[model samples]
Target: MSTETDVDGGDTGDSLTLALAQLHVDAGEVEANVERALAAVSRAADRGADLVALPELFNVGYFAFDLYARNAEPFGGETFTRLREAAADHGIAVLAGSIVEDLAATESVETPAADGFSNTAALFDADGERRLVYRKHHLFGYESAESELLVPGETLETATIGGMTVGVTTCYDLRFPELYRRLVDAGAELILVPSAWPYPRIEHWQTLSRARAIENQAYVATINGSGEFEEATLLGRSSVYDPWGVPLASSGDEATLITTEIDPRTVVDVRDEFPALRDRRR
Candidate 1:
């Protein structure tokens, strides 16, 4: 187990490496997308990444709203099963990004509805076991049908991995700080935000990500897709931020892998030095 030092020169014991797969996704191309995703994971594992994260709705394009219902599948369906196998084979954990979940066939842990759909994220452990699932709570309604087609999630999910507590949240949820606060209160030292955010909002994406890390004093890894859809082109500035709001790694619009070392102890050190979280008032 090799290790790396943090920004402050602290020894990062049991440091975890991450590979953010910024892949170009074609709408309605599930088979090709899955193969790309699996290949990314394998490459990450070859580089000794402890975990790999994909962007939101990579299976079915985020802008391909018309194909949602058709592509929607139950949790642990073929896509998820293959990803789970990939995780097991690669000997790494995977954050299989947002899927167009069939709400009728799926039973959400927080918000259980009889019918409709959801933007969901699934986490698989290195052992190929399902660890956590998070449905998107904040749906984009400004210029989209997300709010109309999907019901918002009602629960916050966290998992213990690589000597840290990691929380899960989707794309639009990044804009809401209150949700992140809840995650912090739930003992989340790191948060994975799988996003499908398009162009014209690059500033918002970067700003909000740093804000979340700064305010919570935690690691915020925002993994975004690098593809363009018929309706929009995704801003592929996928980034990873440390507790001090430093951009550890970032990517441009091309589909590529961005790897970084994350020290679980850095979160504690930053909170001790800054102590903003402790000073928060009601």
Candidate 2:
């Protein structure tokens, strides 16, 4: 009775069904936000999503700068535990990241700051296994306190799932092409970006995401939140771009799920046909 079906109904054994859980995050409301995210996960699984990505700081909405310290969690904290369990129960991979991680309070992992908090993302496979942890390498300093409050991460790593190598990067990191290049070099075929991009910068979001996909020859998915903060409102234009920079699936300014199918071989095919990555001198 499982609703899961292979992407495109082809036994390609390569295509992956991805879902973007674009939730309307309410600032300072941890329980309410987590409940919504859990509901979205169930919905995505019912729609046959093999992987569902939650937005950055979905637990404690990104713009809630004053509440960050109050909600900072450890490596295997409650919010992550619930999502991990949901991943296992529903048989879907979950990218539960960009939480305010209490680095000094975590266990069984090496923290970058040792005594501070960080914007961290964790990838959990369908089996509820921790695949990789990506800390937001770039902290936004544009009239924001993110850079002043949290510690930047130094780890750059990738994990494997659905016959493809997956890499992770958070918001603000999108502005740096070099990071994408590094991920490409590390054999990443699918890169997940969890963001809280605000309004008026829609053009920057679209252009940067597509450019990363085009240049890296990899599938790039940007999962953004939807909600208004005291000083800003999220853009909520979550999208998935193929290796050729074409948007396979997208959404507008709303709390919704954007799902799409991407074949790993498409990456192989595109990179083979274009041969642009081969021309890189840097």
Candidate 3:
């Protein structure tokens, strides 16, 4: 459990109570999985979470490669509208895990492809305003059809919310440190990774997440999915890390919520004290 209090004179927005929804995403079951995610939002809000995040491709499970096209929704379509409504309803921000977005039908933002699909995530504020959108940049090619089936995104967006500069990334983006460096350079204080990592890569998950936080001196929260698929089982290890690379809260291979308080001041203090960021040979 996490408690929330003002870090600064009762009016400081520096503190944020965050929750990670490690959900059991059923393959091709968009309705069921989204309901679960929405329920998790309500649960997190009830427990006093300022923001709650879901895993990558949460509505349509990650390993269900064949179902991406069938379930692909346009940006700001039904799935995201519900999440936006949920955010306003609960008065909490939402990091809607990556969704299969139909680029051709989406008229809101610029698309990477004329009529292809992309893996995208959206952040909605407490007032139900769409804050930021991040499309998965580094698509996984190793033993995965993600690279073949979806068009890669080029947008790197961040939003100012919860007293922090929040940035979003997807699962395979974890392997690319340059992306994180770009985020840090863009004034990101907290990076949320909505991942759908599968089995036999526990060490890779933890290490990559922790390393991103450690190197950037920023908060890193990896929101992973749960449940088994036909060919792979999602390794549910949703976690939150501090600026010092400390695990603030985490969950195992189960459908659970990990809630805890995070502060922007902590990131500021750590960077000011250690100043490892200055050591870079840039």
Candidate 4:
């Protein structure tokens, strides 16, 4: 559980290889979901990906509200341990996306409120050490019961990944520019957004992601789930946007893998050239 502040890991002499796993998860099927995540990690590693990121709440399908309480586990429970092992075995970092976390089972951090459940995301380094734990700050209330069933996170988390300062935000948080600003202020060069975005919001998803990258002059990887639940069908246009708002890699509505090579120096270059972030008034 090492925490890296504004320390830049710098460009590790090579372009960082990133893989986004847009997979389908069965509602309430923890074992099957874990297996799918692990398989994705293995496949990413086999393709020489330095890091792999999974979709939001891939363990317990996002739309499965009833299963959230039933299948919720602690931070270091089966889900965390298995992903850590997978990262170690494959020699690749993993972003084990948002999970239905049982707050009563863990003691390291204080709960956001008294509610015993949270949507948490865990990041494991290539060496298999847990680096960051991020709970979703913005919970969806419109057309969803997330806000009613879970507690919203109170803190922001960041860490160094693939020689670049990286930060995280969940699905609903994409609409908030201030959160992304906080990450930029923290010297984050890249932002990973694990989302469970549903239909009719594809334009919003792509626009917000690219806007964050362009304004902050940093890379943004938005990994989304590619499955259909009883309530809604997730629009899986998982993608990676460069500092200039260019699409590095993108996927359609399918369970697939998206890869891209990101240069940490690009952040610096974009900021220096555009200077939009530097010229911020507020």
Clashes of each: 0, 1, 0, 0
Give the clash count for model 1: 0
Cand. 4 Cα-lDDT: 0.86
Q: Which segments of candidate 4 are over 4 A away from where they belong?
A: 1-13, 109-115
Worst 10 residues of 4 by lDDT: 1-10
* Worst lDDT 10-window in candidate 3: 1-10
Candidate 1 vs candidate 3, lDDT winner: 3
The number of the candidate with the highest TM-score is 2
Q: RMSD for each model, in Å, please? A: 4.7, 4.0, 4.5, 6.2
As for candidate 2, its clashing pairs are 97-121
Considering lDDT, where higher is better, how would the candidates rank from best to worst? 2, 3, 4, 1
* Candidate 3 clash pair list: none
For residues 1-282, what per-residue lDDT tens digits would candidate 1 score against the true structure? 111111121224579887798878888998888888898889889878889999999988898899999999888578888999999988899999989888788654533654788898989999998888899999999889889888888777899877779999999898889999999999999999998999998899999999999999999999988777778889888888999999888888778788888998899999999898899889
lDDT, candidate 3, equals: 0.88
Q: Mind giving the per-residue lDDT tens digits that candidate 4 earns over 51-92?
A: 899989999899999889888988888898899999998899
Candidate 1 residue spans exceeding 4 A from truth? 1-14, 107-111
The candidate scoring highest on lDDT is: 2
* Model 4 Cα shift for residue 260 (angstroms): 0.9
Q: Tell me the whole-model lDDT of each prediction, alpha carbons only.
A: 0.86, 0.89, 0.88, 0.86
